[model samples]
Target: MSRALLIIDVQNDFTEGGALGVDGGAAVAAGVSRLLEAHPDAYDLVVASRDWHDADNDNGGHFAGEQAPDFVATWPEHCVAGTPGAEYHSDLATDAIDIHVQKGQGQPAYSIFEGTTPDGETLSQVLADRGITDIDVVGLATDYCVRASALDAIEHGQHVRVLTDLVAGVADESSASALAELAHAGADVVDSSVVAA
Candidate 1:
């Protein structure tokens, strides 16, 4: 089976010291890079996603303007397109990524499926065209984007594995819940060490 590595939103806005930074986000970025470096051919394709929201407006009410951010639905201004916050974390090696996806352009998007490549191809189309059947997911915010991406991958008929060690979350409880849910949904929630190169 042709396996693909899905890196979800390992951006500066998600890492430590970012707008919506998570505690271990930087570590996840570094760990993912190390994984890619050690297992250069573990997957046939590598795709990375970023939250490229609009800078001019609220991005379809995604950004909290006057109202205080609830942190669930509406969030603070972050990852604006072309901004440094929208850029990928430096620890993540982008040269290994074959497809770069930009999501949440003008709306709320969590799954990588909601994103599109520079040529405007959807994530599903990219995987389908490349005959990708298996996907190993790794990246930031285990409870949010990473969870959504892996769930979408399963729904799209792709076998998915989550590299737990290579992910960081906003909260411990929610992250644990998300992983349990993914495991129940048929995803293999394992550490990266088990993946064969």
Candidate 2:
């Protein structure tokens, strides 16, 4: 089984001091970087997802609206296209990334595989072309994009393992519940230590 690391949204906007920052997001990046360094050849492919949303888009409005639900409307504007916030966190090992998938180009694409690329190929197709079977997920808010990407990977018939230590969430309870849900879905929820081993 060829393994790949699917790093989800380890962007500046999701880190501390940025809009919609997750708790310990920066730490997640650092941990992921270390994991990648420790297991340089463990993965056949290394991919990263970025939340690249438009500045004046409906997705932005979804969070800014008055009638938006508490969970949905709570976050401030983040990851706007071409902004520094949309860029990957500085701590990540950029040289290790073999593929870069930019999501939320128009709307809020939670799943990295769902978004289309500039070359008209989806992330899943790109991975499929490379014959990637095992996917190790990491980064960003574990309750949202990370969870969505892992589930999507399972749906696409890829064995998924989430590096729990390399992920942070905006809400503790929700993140814990999401991890449980991922486990229930048959995805392995392991830590960086497990990856390092």
Candidate 3:
């Protein structure tokens, strides 16, 4: 069986200097790039994901409209489709990614499991098609997308690992909690150094 890497939501909107910027987002992007540079052939498949919310609608009540966002269920306007914020961060080595999955098109999608490729393939389909038995996850907002994606990967019956150094988060406390949850769910919480090809 082959192994795959899931790079989740390293978009400009989630990175530093963009809308809804999270701390260390830019660092995560750069670190992911460096990791790929150091071990380009480590995984058989490398899939990357992003938030591609539609610009017209409020994304199925995901974006708070004229009301204060709770920051849990509702959030500020970010990563709208066709916008620069939706694009991957400049520091990310997009060329190394094999597949691109876009989620939350006019909806609330946190997990990469909720996403599909341009060719309309679901994340699980891609994994199944590629015969992915082990999954390595990394990316932005560790407490949110990364957390959700890791959990879903486990649910999909794949041996999962989250590259601790390769992700950023919106908040520290929640991020720590999310990591604990992932570990409790049987995902290996490791550093990027452990991912050598």
TM-score of each: 0.98, 0.92, 0.98
Off by over 4 Å in 2: 60-69, 73-75
Instruction: Give the alpha carbon lDDT tens digit for every residue of 128-185 in model 1.
Output: 9999999999997899999999999999999999999998999999999999999999
Model 3, 88-150: lDDT tens per residue? Answer: 999999999999999999899999999999999998998888889999999989999999999
Score each candidate by Cα lDDT: 0.94, 0.85, 0.93
Ordered by lDDT, highest first, the candidates read 1, 3, 2
Q: Give one digit per residue, the lDDT tens place, for model 2 in 1-197.
A: 89999989999989998887888999988888888788888999998889887776557454454554566534456788899999899998888898888887666578888776677689888888999989999998899999899999999999999988788997999999999999999899987676656
Count of backbone collisions within predicted model 2 = 0
Q: Lowest summed lDDT over 10 consecutive residues: which window, candidate 1?
A: 188-197
User: What lDDT is reached at residue 93 by model 1?
Assistant: 91
Better of 2 and 3 by lDDT: 3
Q: Return the lDDT, model 2, position 132.
A: 92
Question: Can you list the residue pairs that collide in candidate 3?
Answer: none
**How far is 59's C-alpha from truth in model 3 (Å)?**
0.6
Residue 84 of candidate 2: its Cα lDDT?
96
